[model samples]
Target: MSTNTLAPVLTPERLATAYSYSSYRQLIDELQAQGKTTGLQQSAALTHYTHLNVQRMQRLDKTTQVVPELREAVQNLQQSYMWLVLTEGWCGDAAQIVPVLEAIAQASNGRFTTRYFLRDENLDLMDRYLTNGSRSIPKLVVLRVDTLQEVAQWGPRPAEAQALFLSLKSSGATHEEYAEKVHAWYARNKTQATQQELLTLVRDLA
Candidate 1:
């Protein structure tokens, strides 16, 4: 990757507060034990979702693989990068996506490091990364490690899943209906699209 010409988006102080993947996972478990979720405006529904997300993350942790294309992409990176992810425990997309990201980073042979930031606790950063003007969780902001300058980003959901979401919404599908379909899509996808898209981003960074 070439030297980033843009200003750094994250201050060192902020980056220092981000948690490792293991810490992030432990946090969710700890919070769940206390009947809590990772964000403000908590309720039984949010807590329930958090419970579901934990299971999803656990399954993904055990199953999501770093496809050869993505592994090769990371193996070829000429510069190091940091992936700062904004997420919340109740976020289904984050639950399904974060583990895949961790898997990829771990397989990357030290080419990349990933950190987790609970979205609500980092509103100042989250505000800068809105998707279609909405606060979307699981936003991955890639930075050139040396300068902390952002190279690119990927998140919220894969394009196909996003399209399904929008279609269901515009067609007046119920919230439950859309949610079921979107998550079912994630179940079938099994992280392939996520890895492929990230692979494209990694190549672009190169």
Candidate 2:
């Protein structure tokens, strides 16, 4: 059977239940206190990642400077869009990207708004936008708010980060080694790649 057939249809009703960026962060903070992680799987490693993710998010939330080009592109948008993102607190990629997304949306005035969905809770939606058949978090689905139809999508990681991840995985690097390198790349790039890519996406919509 085709993989597409396995995914659930995304309805507006379903989308409405997703969390706001603020609420999603709050959920993570709340979960952290309980020593829990999102999704069905629970482990010390995952929980540790979740805690690290929160710190990453907090740092990014404080420091992510939205490029003027992206802000202008979003502000010029004639149509409003729903920036639906699939993610998890333990996802390092999501940790680095989602806050930048939120900052962009905030700069949009009201034309771009972000909604956060936990990947484990929204597997059906995540199935629709897999990367190499892997259910990668931080998948963005840009939807026209008026019609609720998808216009563009992006995710999992920026191109450079994806490349680094692939190289590490193929080279038999330990998971810790792989994660460290990828995150260090993010630290150096400092959201520039992500913002530039999203700027292109936003411009096309205008």
Candidate 3:
């Protein structure tokens, strides 16, 4: 996890620079306006393929045992690796956090790029990311560009700990419930450790 500010105060100009940000927001807004509050299915359509990167990362771990090819690739372009998100227009998670990740990646000197994968049709690709016998969307997959392998990932959890936190605040959940869940989750996942690790990973790549 990296320690530098990973989320920034996004301005209009910065938002525009991220081509997918506005479009993604529109998709979520449209659905919400239509009374489609739980956009889980829609999110699945947009973000399922992110799991492929995870599979790729798993393979890298194994391959590096006998071959330096995988490790070499990560080491080579570690600095230019992209926070390649397999996202979609309708996903709440993608809409909210993708921008922040992009901002963080960009602040790191073009080290990250957002890439989309339509989960609706890319079922085969989506299979790579399946966990707990289910498919999920807005799966954030970080990649090492040189090796095209995944470095880290987090998602499919309840919206409380993610960018979806914005919406959960207004949803039916009480403040105490929300705070309790977030605190529990943060403790279970060791978020602070992950952030430190992320920072170290990026710096090492640099």
Candidate 4:
């Protein structure tokens, strides 16, 4: 799997220019207004997934519960950073994870801000953060707000969830089967795993 070598050259100014999540939502709204759907491309599956993710994000936004540990970790953050995320509206993992990330940022009390980029539209940026040579959606690139230097990164999914997904894939489970199981894991985990992992990352940087 290839990893990004050029990431170090990226600066805060460049990152700051990336589209915000609100902008991405505006784009989605425009598409819907045009009687078209989907974030980056036009396809029935993409449209369906896009709408599904919209609803998922809304529901999670209202319902995600942050544990005490995560709240404290974010509260104690001594420096500012940006969670520049590459995702698409059709990405299931993004639907599950992005809201939780937004919650974390919100709890950070302005120490952390998140920006969203459509993975397909930002191929160069996404390529720099690819997972195992694959352009994985919902890739969170954590960068220092002062210097834009990478502090840490997370995503695709939490480790435990990724493990379950890999297990199902290796067993030759169909896409539907694996997807159902992976989402069920998210439903059960309820952002705890993601929060804990992100807390560890933030603590290390602190």
Candidate 5:
């Protein structure tokens, strides 16, 4: 299992201290208010992602549907686990993916819980699970709640979506082109791809 030696492993106590989804929502609200009064001092990427995250999160919260298999798998979980996600408000991928994770946890009926940590602030942990040495956002670190041993890790994007992204990157696509394509893929898939993958991961690990 992937482990972060430089940083302390997250315990339930530690995870509890991180932002919950509701707290994350409040944070975005505050940021939006700040942006309206004075120009957001953050990078353009960060500002744009913050706005996009609000919209994406709201849409997911309203529309995300957990598949029966996923629900059943989670419902049958014999062990307690925590999904410690490393992400940031400015990560577009995180905006699209995190809500689905939240939905899954809720469906598990307390068998699972999720917490968020900013990737930039948790560089030690992020570095331990780098996707090919890059600090990918929205890295899901699944751990057994009892022992805190790492179980499985998933991140950044689904397989098909990541493939599309790599294809565009290899072709030297512009950032706008790449992002548009990725966002379009997410829109078309509507979290189905992500749900299925997580189902498999959770089942195998469980």
Candidate 6:
């Protein structure tokens, strides 16, 4: 099994004490208002931001960022699946992916909701959902809200993101070059331009 080597102390006590449910809701609302059916590129940026929220990271720097494509997809979205985002501060998988998913959810209205599962604190939830008998972090499980159907899952990967790394290996690339390729691939793959596309994709899976 892979492991996290960052070893940055999470200051769990501080994090737990400072947790604010209302603040999280407000952030979602804020992002939603800013995101409407604009274009795929903008949708991509917003989705990236949403994934960051789930990872509990600070927002990206705007000067280096592109304008997000917002669409009015939220109004017509139908909730089909409930998503469980299991994460930790030091886990790279959570860092890169979860926030984008959260952004997509906000764009889709309330079609999606996420609960943060801090593995250090929520071991029971981790055991029920993730834990393949080890103590790693960052597991995302998809469940259909109405029928409780499990849709898909992926995670506990490292900064190099194994799946992404492999996908970038077809050419003679340096490590830095590979990293750029992986980031570009991930960014493009996550964004959904229209409500119809989002609905069709999620519906196919659910």
What TM-score goes with each of the models? Answer: 0.96, 0.94, 0.45, 0.89, 0.90, 0.45
Candidate 4: where is the Cα deviation over 4 Å?
Answer: 1-13, 33-40
The digit string of per-residue lDDT tens for model 1 on 1-206 reads 23444899888888999999999999989999999989887898889999999999999989887999889889888888898999998998899899999999999999999989999998998998898899987999988788888878888898999999889999999977998999999998888888888888888987
Q: Which pairs of residues clash in candidate 5, taking residues 3 or more apart in a chain or in different chains?
A: none
Best by lDDT: 1
Q: Could you tell which candidate, 2 or 6, scores higher by lDDT?
A: 2
Q: For candidate 4, lDDT tens digit of each residue in 106-181?
A: 8888988988877887788888777778887788888767666676788888999989988999999998799889
Strongest candidate by TM-score:
1
**lDDT values of the candidates?**
0.89, 0.87, 0.46, 0.79, 0.82, 0.47
Q: State which candidate, 1 or 6, has the greater TM-score.
A: 1
Of the two candidates 1 and 2, the one with more favorable lDDT, higher being better, is 1
- Model 4, residue 111: distance off in Å is 0.8
Candidate 5, residue 15: Cα displacement in angstroms equals 3.3
Listing every candidate in turn, what is its Cα RMSD in Å to the true structure after a full C-alpha superposition? 1.8, 3.4, 14.6, 2.9, 3.1, 12.7
Evaluate model 2: give its TM-score: 0.94
Q: Which stretches of candidate 1 lie over 4 Å from their true place?
A: 1-5
Name the lDDT value of residue 67 in candidate 5.
98
Q: lDDT tens string, model 3, 79-143?
A: 66545445554443343334444444444445566654545545555566665555666555565
Q: How many pairs in model 3 have backbone atoms within 3 A of each other, for residues 3 or more apart or on separate chains, i.e. clashes?
A: 9
- Cα lDDT of model 6 by residue, 73-144, tens digit: 433445544555665443444545555556556555676655555565666656755545765455655555
